[model samples]
Target chain A: MRRHILTYLLFAVVTFVTWSQDTTAVSTGRHITPVRPSTNVVKQPGRDVSPELIEQYISGDTLAAERKAREDSIRRSYPRYPMMTSLWLGVNFIDPILMAMGQDYASVDVHATLNMWNRVQPTVEVGMGWGKTTPEGMNFTYRAKPSPYVKLGANYNFLFKSTPDHQAFVGLRAGFSTFKYDVDAHYSNSYWQEQTDFTLRGEGSHAWWGEVVAGLKVKIARQWSLGWTARWHHLFSCKDSEHSQAWYIPGYGPRGRALAFTVSAYYTLPLSLDRWPRKDSNYSAIR
Target chain B: MPLAWFYGSGTTKQVTVGNVTVYAIGAPGDTVLVNNQSVNELSLPLRVSTDRTQWCLTFMTTDSLFVTDTLTLAYRPIEYFASVECGAMYVFDLQQVTSTHNVIDSVLVTQPHVTNVEQVNLRIYVPTAQQ
Candidate 1:
């Protein structure tokens, strides 16, 4: 009876051990749900992003600091200085060509300008102009001698932020000229049986005018440039003689409002190149 | 309309008078006798003849003593298309001008070429006493 009882106890222990192992397996299985095969799902490629780079992009303070650094670098490239002067010798090609066509006009000018900040250019121009016109079948012959004139003005470049080699600008000028003119008119009256010839002279007559100018300048080489300007001139006042009005006012062109055109080649003499700050790599992108 | 401008000598200002009469030389019946005429202000619309190359204008003064003066203008008729709406008009370029010495002492062609632009092309010099 004792052996039978021992056998029963060992069998019961074995059954209990099997039952506990099964329960443990079932509990572990209950934690995991069955995954079905999804035909409609798609997988996208993942980008490898570093934590440091992400932090830098999200931070506003980092962006502001970088922008300030770039601005400071650009400001250091173009330093402010005193007057930077440049002298230019120019000519009006149109006037001389028109003179050949019997329109009778010619002008030559010299210019000096102070370039400030590569933005504002204050200029002074001195020129001599002369013209004569005798209309066909007219008894009068009008003549104007070469006379010197002066203009003071400033030009504002629209492309100030770009390279200094090229400029598109609009300018204003106040001009004055003192000139001499002569008019000879001859008339014959058949009915009166009389003939008369009269000569009128206007000496040392002064004229004042204003001009609105638009021009383009392109650099052909180092210290050399080609430019053309169109001007609309308005006469303010003109001194007239007793017998006749001044037919042409040297720099002013005609007696009234006139349009003038000029094409010029410039030889720039940079007066203070070493004194002014040089352009740096930042503006090299525009060049 | 085709028009031409005339002015008195010495100035471009309009000269006002009490009475004046204008007549075409060949067509004596066609006359415009204006009372209180403004000489410089008048924009004369010239009549061109197909048969003749010259136009004659006679001016009569209605003062205490009636005085007359004649002006002859020789021109070349130019036919050009001014615009679509304007169709065509005759533009005259004065070749020669002659005036009778009476009230008008002399005449000068300041601008021989005339266009639609309003300008003083002829400067008529009247006698000092008449002026």
Candidate 2:
């Protein structure tokens, strides 16, 4: 009977020890929350609160106020100014270099523009062109004397929100020219087996065209800039002689539709300084 | 004058008749028969070639016995802007025209220049009585 009691006691002891080891292993595998003592107490019914929640609410409000203050300071720094106007004079450099090639055409153009609020520029260009060409395979000689032409246009600067010292623009122009041309050629009919020499002279021939232009300008000095523009020209109308066509137009370039490129240098002159925004003025904006 | 000012220098050549059946001849398949392309009701718009100075147009009648005629035109293509919307086009100045006297009695150059102005430029006189 004593042996039986001892066996039963040993079985109970082994079962209790194994259960304690399993409980210890499960507790160690899980994340344990440390008990911290609460310093603040909430007086709400059936609710308990700590000091960390109140401190977090206070910090969130403080951060929002700081963000608002920073935005207000940025707004105060950049302010809008009143509309201002300036004048610019520019000369195209590509025509002179093209004239040296002796390909029967040359042009020199000078432009004047009014820059308004550094956004829109209204402009007018005047130029003189002349050329003479005798094509190699053709039995014809064409000559055009120096004639004057004019173009009126407006350009909208895309970089108006940036610095005034740099500009990227797109523009439209309407050009007109009246000039004279002389053509000496021989007309031959193969079926008729006849050749006739003819000389045609055209005076006061007028040509008109429209252009879409894109350009960029960069400030090189305090009041000087360097610029380049590409233009796509569409010929609208041209008055020609009965047997002759105008080979070259003064400001309109070739007699047909063409793409033209020009490099220019510009000088800006301030006519009225009072109308311009002061550099140190608080209301002066970059645009 | 305002309409002319708006259309600019681009003009198109239109061929029409008061009371006549006109069919433009084209070669389909292996045979060179009348291709049955009709331009009688609505006038046909002709486009000039960019490289060639001449345009050949052949016409056939729609009667029981078809009579065919060929007209050749010599012109100079002038590049000009038709309108702000149309962009650009070639306007032709009629220099000379020759036609075969088959069913067509005579051909008249009513307008010497052709543009995009939508007007009848050539007048074809066909025989009033058909065989």
TM-score of the first chain alone, every candidate: 0.67, 0.66
- Minimal lDDT window, size 10, model 1 chain A: A44-53
Docking class of 2: incorrect
- In Å, candidate 2's interface RMSD is 11.2
- Model 1 residue runs over 4 Å out of place are A1-87, A202-204, A271-287, B1-131
Ten-residue segment with the worst summed lDDT in candidate 2 chain A?
A: A45-54
**Model 1 chain B: ten consecutive residues of lowest lDDT:** B79-88
Q: After superposition, which runs of candidate 2 have C-alpha atoms over 4 Å from their true positions?
A: A1-82, A190-193, A274-287, B1-131
Worst 10 residues of 2 chain B by lDDT: B1-10
For all the predictions, what are the DockQ values?
Answer: 0.04, 0.03
| B13-40 per-residue lDDT for model 1 (tens digits) | 4454334555445443544433335454
Query: Residue by residue across B11-109, what tens digits does model 2's lDDT show?
Result: 233333232233323312222222345343233323333322222334444555555566656677554433223333446777776678775666667
**TM-scores for the candidates:** 0.52, 0.51
